[model samples]
Target chain A: MKVTWSRRHVLETDDWSREEIEHVLDTANGMLEVLSRPIRRAPPLRGRTVILFFAEASTRTRVSFELAAKALSADVVNITATGSSVEKGESLLDTARTLEALGGDVLVIRHGSSGAPYFVAQRVGAAVINAGDGAHAHPTQGLLDAYTLRAKLGDLAGKRIVVVGDVLHSRVARSDINALVPLGARVTLSGPPTLLPAAWRCGDLPSGVGYEPDVDRALDGADGVIALRLQRERQEAGLLPSIREYARTWGLTEPRVATMRPGAPVMHPGPMNEGVEIDAAVAHGARSLIEEQVTNGVAVRMALLYLLIAGGEPRLIVGAEPPTSIAGGEPPATPLPTGVV
Target chain B: MTTFDRRALEAAGYLVVPGFIDLHVHLREPGFEDSETIASGARAALRGGFTTVCAMPNTEPAIDSPGLIAELVARAKAANAARVLPVATITRGRKGKELADLVELAAAGAVAFSDDGSPVDDARLFRSALEYARAADRPVLEHPQDLALSARGVMHEGRVSADLGLPGIPAAAEEAAIARDLALAKLSGARLHLQHVSTARSVELVRRAKADGLAVTCEVTPHHLALTDAWVAGDRTVAWEGRPSPRATPFDASTKVNPPLRTEGDVRALWDALADGTIDAIATDHAPHASVKKDVEYDLAAFGISGLETALPLLLGGVDAGWAALDTVIAALTTGPARVLGIDVPDDDWTVVDRAATWIVTAAGLASKGKNTPLLGRELRGRVVMSVVGGDVRYEGDLRAAPLAVR
Candidate 1:
């Protein structure tokens, strides 16, 4: 189906319509086929440049974006704040402009400040993909999680999806709620009062979402679960009494999983604290989709690079004149193999 | 009156009133000249229809000594744009630990004492400062905030901050500090003036203090009177009383300010306070910062709005919408602030305003170097055509040209 995608940047899922989100999921299906192939190379973004500007430390998201760009044959450069000009007090806009001046076509930015990518996207012309700005939106993570859930549960409408732990500080939980509520999934956030503020219960939750401080009650009759990592800094800030108490009360455990509907899947955005937020047994268990989420992360990101750089209309890249310039002679045109059009 | 004077007065939408006096302004001079100098800030004051402005002492080298006060006064005289009054810091270096020499500062032409950027958090030290300031006969202007409650918050705590996932400064932060200061004022029998009072509960506290006959006064900023915390959402329609406009930019750092903008209910409470005489004056709190400070992430950006150039049109818009009486608004700007400083509004100083004149606010059009206003692109309804001070035409012409009488 030819859907008109007018958005040039992916900053947050708050403003995205259900159709736009479904379009990205549909495009990721084709990228999954491409990833499954032995060669795994694509020519859609052959001559484009993708810059990974990670001002914060990350292993999963950074690798996922780099591999996704490489698979599409785009040039990728990585910049971290440790030894770069950012450490010397250079501003985020200056760094983005330097990348833009060097011919970067798409800038993937991750910063410790919330709204850092939105700050850069307003100033630069390059397409910006937010790689988890501070406690703000992580649109691609939300997309991949949605993709994984749809693959397992068939349809998300009217499904009870419980998101557990440190929700006030987790960009993942925010994006998940933003992504799920529109697709008709009833999301309930559960955590301690310090981590899940009472404001979320008093008319602050988005339509079709609820707040439950008790994890057991939230998990009752849930179709799936997404457990967020509880950083130790919350304890340092006097939010939690101790990690052990948090685990004993709010953490997802074997008994907690048994309270859910039978065969309900469990997911976690990774680098989890094994005994803290989720037990190791539940993470590596049969119904866990944590590994599938990492794989789907690459696919979802590849689809984003393709749609944003290729202007959402696949015919423009497949058969019509290519939008971005090709360095070598024009590669032979090939129709997208997975019925993406 | 002369025939020419009468003719000009009879002209459509033109009104001549006493020149405005701003009790709070951060002429970021002795330090941070890249953002604004004393001379440039004075020029901005003249262009904004203010004949007299009290300079805040939060600059670098902290205006704590008589020599710094004399130097600031000298710089303002050299600029010769608007009358600038020096406000000395209550603490020796505005460190909130030790009190500065209030007797010497008051003797050196300091009209007020304040720790404008940081509140005097120490109760014992604050009590001593208030007692000393009373003897010196200068009102202790406080920037009311409990840092512990407002820790690391970038905007107001409410439904908006919850959705944006940013740290929030709850209304309790300001209310708690106000309650403390009012009790201190009652204990010491000293004059207390709060700067940039932002919350509804803060107004109620001040109103109660006034009814109890405590010497308490407070001022509200134009931004807080008109704009709400929703401005951080980048939607102008929700931010103020304006037409539904498209989002200029999302997560704009320009909307970031200290004691961040509160909800619409709070804004309404402020208007009610102003109408009923709970709010003593309308001070600009005209803090300016270089673009380098405001062009970063909203969290990393400095907390202020370059508000000197926009204060008049913003309030006049409120008056036009029947939110406040014109006489009350003008008095809050002119005679009201004059009474706060215990100074006389000079008879010769006047501002000529064209209420029907409309202009769009742009960065390049501003006299102040800081262009960090959330109203950057909106059309404002009034303009100051001329400003007069001490029988001299200090500023005349459209805002495009420099003032005519720079010393």
Candidate 2:
């Protein structure tokens, strides 16, 4: 099915449809094939500039997005909030405007504030990508998680995926539910009652989403599971007791994985709190898609940058003179060669 | 007081009524003067057909002592547009600890006492303030909120906050504080006026407290009665004047008001309370902040909306929308607030409002220094054609041609 790419900002997955999710997964699969090629680069976004403006410290998302932009032959400029004019009290909009003025084509922003990218997108004509926002959304991470699941277990229709831990502060949990639910996956969130209140389960969240306090009950017969990082501050804030207690109670151990359907992939949007949120034994085990999720993260981000920047409407990306126009290539689009990276 | 040109007023064919008395207005002076001052706020109030407005005591230093109260009164007198009665802080610097000298403040012309902007959370301290305020014959207006329950919450906790992914400040945060303060008000037999009441249960609690013969009177803001969280649910974009941009999405900060705009059901309940006389007044709660303070990200932005210019027109539009009867709306603005403040409202002082006149809201049109209202650019019915305060023509919307000729 032919779908028009209209959205200029990839802020959240809430507005994503089933077809959009499938299209992203398919595009990521194509990009995965491109990753295996000898040259491992595409000319679609050849001269475009993609800025990585991260206010928060991130390893996987930053590097993955950087690699994706580089692989597409776009110039990547990385900026951090610390030791910059941002620290000198420059407002978020001012910084964004400055970057746009400096010829930023597509801005992939990871801000500590929720809706920061949306704020920037409204001000500038450049394409905005929300790499991660505070407890709000991480669309690429969600898409990659979904892609890894789809690649592993085939079609995800009617599958149950259990997302465990710190749902209140987990942007991944929000993005995951937004991405997976519409694709016929019944997602159950499991966490300490304080961390995942009943209030988060309501509102615009999908009807297929449910919550269970018992980790075991949530993981029972789960087709997949995504473990969230538990910040130590939760204990200090009295949201939980101790890390040891959390590990014992909610952590994904090998024993807990055994209760799930055989080879039900375990996932974590990384920099994992190994002992606290997930046991290292299960994380590195054959059934865990931890490494595959990371590998697919690059592919998914490549797909996003490609589709959004390269394949996006030309009117959205301001100021950059493209060397090659991806818009010219449409209608029975050329597929990337299917090879393993 | 300057005398009104009665002959000119007659020539204009304007209807006159008592000057509006706003019980809750944040002049933001003595500190955040960049947003509002005594002169700017009084001018804004006058433009809205208000002659008297009770200024909240949540300034930088707070109107805690008789000295500060005297200073505010003096400043308002110099401003000369409206009567800006100072409301003293309940506690020292509004820290919610150590009661201020309420009797001295009252003697110095403080109309009421409130720890607005920050709630007087401590039950004992608040109760003490109530007891002391009873002696002064001034009501203790509480900005009812349990900070513990509303920790880091940016908007009303419900379906909308859930949808927006912003932390929810549950209705219980206001309801719980209201319930406790009402109980304390009853215990002390002190006059208590709840400021900016925003939830359904809050109205219900206030209604019951009043029924139980408690000296409880509450005021709802015009924004609270007209708008819901849906306005802020998404980007909260408004086409505010100035600044080059066509759209201003306060994102989180734009609509980041305290006791955040509640649900539609709560809006309906506020009108119900107003209709049944359960709610006493419609206060503007015209809190203003500089664009630098408000135009930032949601979590970092200050709480408030500059409502002085838009309050009467919006409520009058509300009447057109069938939100309330015109008489009821008029009573809430004038007599209702006058009763809450326990002041003998002068029957002679009034502003002529053209019920048929329509005007679109604009930042340039507002007399207030702060251009931070949500109603900008929206065409609203009802315009204050001429405002007379203390027999002086303070605001004349059409007095453009003749600078000194009152007509």
Candidate 3:
């Protein structure tokens, strides 16, 4: 009668709660302080050995985690999960056990199945952090996105944000769903009908997420914008006529970004398709946090590393609110939950 | 010279068998009139040649208290042609969480205690019931089912149901309960009587338990012994609607019973249990329901068919027709069940089974309150000429007038 769930086991946003979202965001603020310092790093994962297991091709995240580990002075092992003994029928469970046997402390996995990380983490007794999996989740990218927005807008509650582009195939969309919903911002998933799983209900997601098919409808109540990457690997064979046809219907140009709630930030999850996805003018535009997100990525990874390893001491807390301890153990803050003082 | 000693004449082609016993039957009372009543049903039982019957605890008010048991016993005494022994519920209700007043119920002449239609789910409560039964020196007739496993399920889960688009009720639901109950019995030292043991494997468990000296016994319904899932299908809309289905459909309001029917192999296995003494007895499970209530779809059908008048004839007819031997047949109906209930049956009962005497049974001519007679219009082989309850004639049949003897 009892079952447990962990990691990016689900394919959409509403998986993370608002309180949990805020906790991660609070942790992110601690990360920002680590950035402003001259040392740029500290021992977060001191005695821990972290293994970055990525079977998918990677770019920013792969480097960010390794550098994050190096900055924290933890031993690190990077292994591609494909074409190993696993292809010879080694279960995800057996491989995880083998890795744990080798003294691997944490498994940071990115794979092609939506719940692969969850499966691996559950099979062996290990703490798992999802990197990216099958158009499902990129938790680190989601943290960087929130860390960027929180830096500018102060607190995210009542903030307006719109995510654009081929969100239908972005693992970052799944992560953003978890991040944005609880950060106190409203989210609408806008994409073609074919991209939607029929069973998906906006309420069924974690706290603050929703789905919509119309871009104009999304822009109507928008705050900030997050444009996701198009994974050509996700396209059904011959389902789409051509790249031009996809661009005409679903692409996000600068003009589209201009229609958001005024002063709302624009963001992307990197490896952008240039003029085809979002016009070049907007990619390098002044209103964009695209570069700040990567810088925030290393900072967030450092923050995550510090909290996960050395456990950061609370510093001169800034515009950020206190950690919302909704962890069943804490007493309700106001005799009941209300906005943080 | 002898105008013919009908009772003694009845003793020849067959043995002067004592009245057969049925440990389960539902004489739906307190309100449901269209279905059945103790009066007409007992008359049917008399005609069926059962000298004694054990009434189920599931009724209008439910037989959970001494007052309800007394009420049913009163109605049964006034109505019965046979001795009626009603099993009282083991809880203030058959809710199964709390133990009922076992000592009080046993004092009120309850043949046994059971929560039959519903299984007691909570393990601690069931163990408590078993302990209570042990202390009271009575038996707990368990309705074998783990509700969670058998949720919203209808037919036995197998190939037939898959093809018919029927929901599967896995054998595990029943077997799981049986296994747990036997273990509980082992711990409590109480006797356990398994109700409607349909599968061969279930009989094997009881046999093993008996060999190991655990006080365990089981009963199989006539329907489970005789019907199968093939009855669920039909040729060109019921050309193969099955021999039991048509007659059952009329009174079928009461035709639906739980542990719904198993497969053909299970039926054969039940017969095998009868032959090998694996099954201790045959119970009509004579669940009666009104005709109006049966008009619903098979999925929602009430579970009974009139068996008061059919139990003896069916088993005896089945024997005469080569479906079973009379020795195996009589043992299931008489001493096999009597011993399960701890009754000391005398030796000279079967001398009254007159095989030559004919039975004129037809649904058109029955007096049962249930209109859903599954055997209507089918001519079965044997009939009870009369019942001798306590050395007295409780029932007698009219002689068939011959052309010359008509004068």
Native contacts recovered by candidate 2, as a share? 0.29
Tens digits of per-residue lDDT for model 2, A191-301: 887787446554334478888889998888999899999999999998888988999999999989888898899999988988889988998997889999888999898
Per-residue alpha-carbon lDDT of candidate 1 for residues B182-291, written as tens digits (9 for 90 to 100): 99999999999999999999999999999999999999999999888888987786334567777766679889998799999999999999999999899998989999
Chain A TM-scores, per candidate, are 0.92, 0.90, 0.79
Model 3 per-residue lDDT tens digits across residues B159-183: 4443333445777888888999999
DockQ of each: 0.62, 0.34, 0.01
Residue A117's lDDT within candidate 1 is: 87
Better of 1 and 2 by DockQ: 1
Candidate 1 i-RMS:
1.4
Models sorted by lDDT, best on top? 1, 2, 3
> For the second chain of model 3, what is the TM-score against the true structure's chain B?
0.87
Residue B393, candidate 1: alpha-carbon lDDT: 81
**Per-residue lDDT of model 1, residues A65-169, tens digit only:** 999999888989888888788899887888878877876778998888888888888778899999998887788999999999988997899999999999888
Q: Between prediction 1 and prediction 3, which has the larger lDDT?
A: 1
CAPRI grade, predicted model 2? acceptable
